[model samples]
Target: MGDFSALGEKLKATRNKMGLSLSDMSAKTGVSKTMLSQIERSESMPTIATVWKIANGLKIKLETLLDDSSQLYEVKSIDDKLAIKDDDGRMIIHSIFPFSPISGYEVFYGVFKPGCNYSDDNHTNSTTEQLFVTDGELEMIVGQNTYRITAGCSLSFDSSEKHRYINNGDIDANVLIIVNYE
Candidate 1:
């Protein structure tokens, strides 16, 4: 059986390691103590919004919450490492490459499900955004232009432009999106 309980335990441990209490998180994230406790106990799976709140409260990325696997660079089975979400809500599954120098780039992978589009937030820094479509098709809106990206196609554009991704495909669209946080 998949150990979702262990996943909850790991999340709890990460929060405790940061010396944060449930009350502290509640105050910081506005998430109720009871809800957080249930999440920690594996009684409930947190939604994307709830996960965002917890990650922000812990001052970490959303990927950190799902990284219950072994050390970075330790190869594991694809099913063991991939964090999949079926909900149409905004879910960001990330894999931050291990032990890389802090440069201007932050690399990760994302899958925007059909008709799903995240907030059109511009970059916080002067940066470049690149995307390589791996499966299906997606419509990427960069400022005014909407480009149809198909499998094996790639795009690079200014990160400062207000951008959003939509899965124009009938199925989920997978893409590797890299943000150059220069």
Candidate 2:
């Protein structure tokens, strides 16, 4: 689970840094003042949609709103990476690159068990994903098209459309995914 209190603190700090009061934030984000207050007080957890709106209103990247401040440079090994698992536990994604507005990109190392399928909704407009397969096979479906990506192969596609990744091979599928935001 995410640390809602930390998120709330970041929101409040960002708003304060911008010299925006609750009313100002509400006006800019089109979110109810009460809701914003609740979120800032850690009494409520904002939905992804609400967060997106807030990020847009603040004119910052979504990652900027969520990322923790770090040193000028950092290194992360496999064990240091944070992994997110799917609800069904058949897919796992390790964040290989920490989110940063300056980089304008996010990277993940994903593992899909045989027969597992991961479906994703459209991302922000003009976002693109480059996927490189390292092991096994992956079936990628983007919009109305489908492509079979084998080991050592790479595929790039606009991620602003619905997509799915299926591991139909007998073994686990390993893929490196890089997402670039426009």
Candidate 3:
């Protein structure tokens, strides 16, 4: 079983340790207070974009949300990985980076096991996300429309548009998600 609830609890604790209230986080990240509350309560999972917003707002790195002991070090390969576990202790490999210089944009390799997913949210600036499927399939729901991308396929869209990704396949799915902050 994954422990996403514990991860959420740690996120809440970190937010409190930084002296940031839910309202403050919502204001800073543009995420709704209601949704933030749900995340804290382990009722829902925060999307990658949501996590990025919270990380930037908290003036902390993304890895901090995964593990409290991770330093401000950089990751530069498939071996360097981060996982977000669900309350049931199901591990989801959240992000991956390769050996390269840090640019304004953030890149990630997302691996979604069967029946896993994250919802979409709003963005401040003109953020863009491009995903290339490596294995299995992905069901992307953007606004009221839904699309599927299979292995060897890719898709890109603006972050301002509401979007979500789910793995409806019985096997695992791998995707490289790249986000451009600018």
Candidate 1 has its poorest 10 consecutive residues by lDDT at 95-104
Strongest candidate by lDDT: 2
- Cα lDDT tens digits, model 3, 55-140, are 77766677666654444565466664666655233225455542211244566767777777677585666478888999999999
C-alpha RMSD of candidate 3: 14.3
Candidate 2 C-alpha error for residue 78, in Å? 1.4
TM-score of 1: 0.51
* Native-structure RMSD, model 1: 11.4
Report the candidate with higher lDDT, 1 versus 3: 3
Off by over 4 Å in 2: 1-75
Ranking by lDDT: 2, 3, 1
Candidate 2 C-alpha lDDT tens digits along 144-174: 9999999999999989989999998899989
Question: How does each model score on TM-score?
Answer: 0.51, 0.60, 0.51
Candidate closest to the true structure, highest TM-score: 2
- lDDT values, one for every candidate: 0.72, 0.84, 0.73
Instruction: After superposing candidate 1 on the true structure, give the runs of residues whose Cα lies further than 4 Å from its correct spot.
Output: 1-73, 76-91, 98-101
